[model samples]
Target: MTKKTKSLVVVMAVTAMMLAACSGNGNNNGEQATAKPEATGNTNGNAGADKQEEPVTIKVLAQFGRADLTENEKAFFQKVNEALNIDFQLVIPPSSGYAEQLQLTLISGDVPDVVFFPSEQDEMFINAVRDGAVIPINSYLENSENLKNYSYEHSWEALKTMRDDNIYGVPRTSITRNDGFMVRKDWLDKLSIEIPADNEVTLDQFNEILRAFTFDDPDQDGKQDTYGVGSYVDANKVLLPVLVSELGHYGWQKSTDGSYPFMLPEYDAQSDVYKNILLYTQKLYAEGILDPDSPLNDSAAASERFKQGVTGVIRGFAGHVNAQEKVLKEIDPQAELTYLFVKGPEGKVQGTGYGTGIWGVWAVTAESEHPEKAIQAFDYMLSEEGWDYLYNGIEGVDYKLVNNEKVYNPDISRGIATSIMRRHNAPEFFLDPTKFTKEELDRVSPWVDKAVATVVTSMDKGYVPPAAREPQYMDYKLTWDELTTKIMLGDLPIDQLDKARADWYKNGGEQYLKEMNEYIQSLEN
Candidate 1:
């Protein structure tokens, strides 16, 4: 292999080996991105090159991207203050009011230095760019000395997406694409179990495995202390969980071969896929695998179960396993956790975030002291060094580079993320793919490979119509959150699922699909 190739391999190997050592930082916010960077990523007295002069307090607007800062974040930032000379007066708003609040603030003509958004409000931002509501970040990419050396992957898609004159705000791509990873590896070890080497298993066999984990005394507690399987989130968060537990068990997409066509049961305002999934969920509850109280449990309670060791087998995507394993180690220290990915019918499972192949497209208002300065700042965010610090956190504190790539310390620092979900608002997480590094890719490769391998062996995963996801179509999805878990986790019989599906179709389901097909066709046009 080439030296570059060999070096990449070593970096990945080191990260994989040390994954257990680095439990991981949990975001105070509910979700988004891979992992936020720690404030002062200073390791071994070197945080890469020196930063430029620190400016006065920059009034920055941090959209409600994360929950809040932990004590660790504060400590790291305190250290940062020692070196840098700027106060990042962050403006964090609630998710519900993020766009509205931003608009209100802008109308008052009092915008922050940095304008952040989680999911892009493309329409408003586009108009803002036209009206000069945002400061362009082009110059920053070239001039900002502090951010010029930032490392990590920053895809072109992200870079281009966050621009108007093709020059706009900085894009801090969140790491949300990695999902459907990790299972109870420690449990597997305790049971002296070996995973299905093939990665592909029929729904029935997958069910049996979950039952084995839940029913069998793998832990040897004697009593029927384990559940066959479990689910999380009152609604959609739990979808991926079931997908993980059962692997190729029950799903809407069908096939024994070829690509799983995106078959979202044509949202027949009469036969919607959303309700169909819900009905099957109810069946899972009837079978005694799903947690009934999942709907009522707050984020803290739900996450605590996995962290404290009450739930042995659980599933989530992206950083879920990494973070969970970290908590497990702290709880018991020797906790052995594994993320055995699930397979679909067509056997094409992947443990990355659903591809949002779009640029972030941040705009600047015409009214600003340094419109070019704003663009320059954003450009810095997109630079190699800017992304490196953002992705890896303040250098030595978070990682050290033996090779050209980043080698994390398991304790990768993300000073941006807070400790509590509702306490402080974090606005910097805007996920764009261009910012990923080969090291990051290598680090998560094994689990992702397993996911793909599972798909290879599974039947098929037909595409679910994207219409059910569009804003207009989503409005029709009545079986959301609380109601969804209530029905799915209850003792609903499997036989009634068909009628429920039909009922959903009658309730705005068909319109959802019509809108979807129209939208899809328009894209082609």
Candidate 2:
């Protein structure tokens, strides 16, 4: 079979298996799959399970991508069941409706023992902490050497606290450069365009490249159906550094004084730099340089366009590169992609405020029967040994270490539904480098290095709106949306941008700035 055909076959098999697995649903019995060490007389002395303590059952409220466990997943549970003297009744909410389900559960006062606050559940977590719905684990954490060590590498200080000074949650970190731009390198080669130095293209060179992509038929099919770029307004904010530099701050500007940029005169929408971005986007829309449907399309739509080879340039997280390449390669084996940093006049700059350093957090609810056991279980899970077991499967079964690099079993690597491997942590965790192969390590090395460098760069250049200013940010965002829509539709002239800025300050902008700085001062003092 052809390579493409083989990939399809493998994907189909994985899909079918996944369907079968999900279809065979069960209650939270996986937690009870293991017999007690005393009953089974199985005392191998795993690092996680302290054989001395009698097993305790704990309920966990976790986010699940889907319901039901694959055979491999079942095995993973069975292993954990034996390793730890804890019975875990996993309450998994459907991935699609997790937020709504969790919200309703919270409203009903049915918070579980150990609640997982994934990235999507941030707001809910904050409210829970504020309302005293979750128990604070600060004292427990101080005693956990493993969790404490893991916390140091991530944004534990910020993540642990809410409005209060006490630590309320344990953070999970996924450390990697999540954003970058990529182009169809095959198209560049086919069109005889020289790849720019250091994979950085100047604005003029990039425009030329886009022009060729749009008009010169770089795909060589003699059809004028291709678009130069695939971008939505959200992606544009990142892919176009000029806009990011001027209007980049989420809401609050970089200020030790906590000054709000939106409320300031100099950073108003009518400013020269800000106007350039607006006009440039308008120009792109008018000249067919940008995706015609970009304003209306969402990220998934743009991704579909790229997959169908309708666009040559796209921006996304670095981890998405492999997924994009896989899809594009399936369409045309010759299709090749490469990362690029498009440089504006100011030089190459990545989008700031990409993340809050914490993916999600874990908190214990007062309702948990055994809060200590729940915390202990989670503490162990974040340890080096537990991380290895949870991230990889059984050492010799699901993966093998060759020269200190982990090689996953074929079934796991091919996306088969299995219990022996998982990447999700109930509360918090980070990627383990020792589990990566040489090729995987090399592919992600640049992104990893760039992630570290960008942290420092972003500290000086990035603008993160203080959490206290979320409401003000929302109001400003609503106004900007209206203004952007008007500007794009030509209903409002470009010169009227100044009026919009003035109107923003008149509408709670001043109050927002004053309150924001006050909150910042309170935190600092």
Candidate 3:
């Protein structure tokens, strides 16, 4: 039998065994095998009067992007302590080494009370659940309306898929927004290139603009130094933003075959969409319109190149336009940016979707003395008063209310405030009117709105197939990276992608498809 058929057979056999086991155990209701501990103290409120008398110390291990906490971050923690009446022993390692630190912590059997996992699909997290190192928070989640209501349903479903149908973590919510190409409006005006009225450009128009930007001296610098586009390689492949305008999809697409409901559009058997994207990119590279250093650049390097005026166009986040413009203007006062919505060959203007609306997850460890307090702390972060502090920071310290309008303190650092604890995935939080002046809002709002409106989410977003974690799958990913990069750089012919696709099936791709579809089917049933 083919690998795909074998995978389906294995899935069916496993499902049958699971059914038989449930029938024999008289526990077919899909409940946890071990009885979960009842959450202690008041579940609705933060820290109750009785609990405040004897403060509970909850240790929290989280990922902080920076090396150390800023003064505002310290104050934010102090505020949380006063409100919650919980002594939070925070273990904030730098984000660069956090995964390694987390692995070490798990291996040492010294896991914190509340652990923050950067990814829900982390193998360590899976093993921790299997080893009973992390406790299921379903009982606590049932009582915490703020936690449950604010978090996306898909996030809970994703966590449930990891272990039985039990939520093991509190989702650190993130707003699902799109990113698109930000072009130099100054350059466009200098070259007298008129974009479409709706800001969406056709593929042919896009190519011409790139040529103009590269060859027509759009910067008016009298130098042939600038490229048309700036991009970086992520995971040894060209960044998605650079190709999404052509491909129309980010990662996975709903399969034409019902047996395997999801397929990676890049390796899809029915179409040459991915190959066409590579050829387009190759043409740009050959014509010197695409950045030469793109294969060597990371996200930071690519952004820097754009900011320093090395390139006229680069992929940018919708919400970060104002900040990016500020940086660009610092170098050249006349520099201006505008977002572009490129109409794909399929006649669609689209941007990639962020799956599950979750950036990270917070799980309570079984070693905790007060799992209930940890849950309460997380729930509090989602509350109005708590979210206000997390999002806006201390009212007087971070911002002052003047005529019922928030006036932010310019000196205070608000970098780590909203993300240090948990986040609520509200678009209003990111696009807060109070944070920007009228001029900035008028300039940035349209792009943000456009991006949000054009997002195309994947069909199999939150589901992780079992075969994905296999060594063969990882090997296939490496092979994919190498082959795609080489093809884009013109080192290999376009037809080589066919070999990569075939290699993918040989190396766990067939099983990956079967397992993901089965999981998706189970959800539907």
Kindly provide the TM-score of model 2 when superposed on the true structure, using C-alpha atoms: 0.75
List model 1 lDDT by residue over 1-525, tens digit each: 544324433433343334324434322222212122234445332223233543333334555445365444544444433333334344444454455555555565545555554433365665565576764555545655433332112222233334323555444433323245345666667766677764334556556666666667655668766554555554345332355323233322332332222124322223344455566556666766655445555556656766665556555554345556667888777776655444544554543223222224334444444454444444443444444444445545665677776565654345453211110011123221123355454445555444333322111111134455656446445453334445566644434445545655666566554554443343334
Q: By the lDDT metric, which is better: model 2 or model 3?
A: 3
Rank by TM-score, highest first: 3, 2, 1
Q: Residue pairs in steric clash, candidate 2?
A: 72-419, 72-420, 73-418, 73-419
Best by TM-score: 3
| lDDT score of residue 60 within candidate 1 | 47
lDDT per residue as tens, model 2, 88-200: 55655455445655665566565566777775236787788889888787777766777766543325546545546577766655443424567888898988988754665
Counted clashes in each candidate structure: 95, 4, 0
Q: Which residue runs does candidate 2 get wrong by more than 4 Å?
A: 1-49, 71-84, 96-111, 118-127, 145-162, 174-178, 196-198, 233-251, 255-273, 344-348, 401-406, 413-441, 448-452, 455-477, 488-492, 521-525
Global lDDT of model 1 = 0.45
Model 1, position 481, has a per-residue lDDT of 33
RMSD list, candidates in order: 13.6, 9.3, 12.3
Each candidate structure's TM-score, on Cα atoms with residue i matched to residue i, is: 0.57, 0.75, 0.81
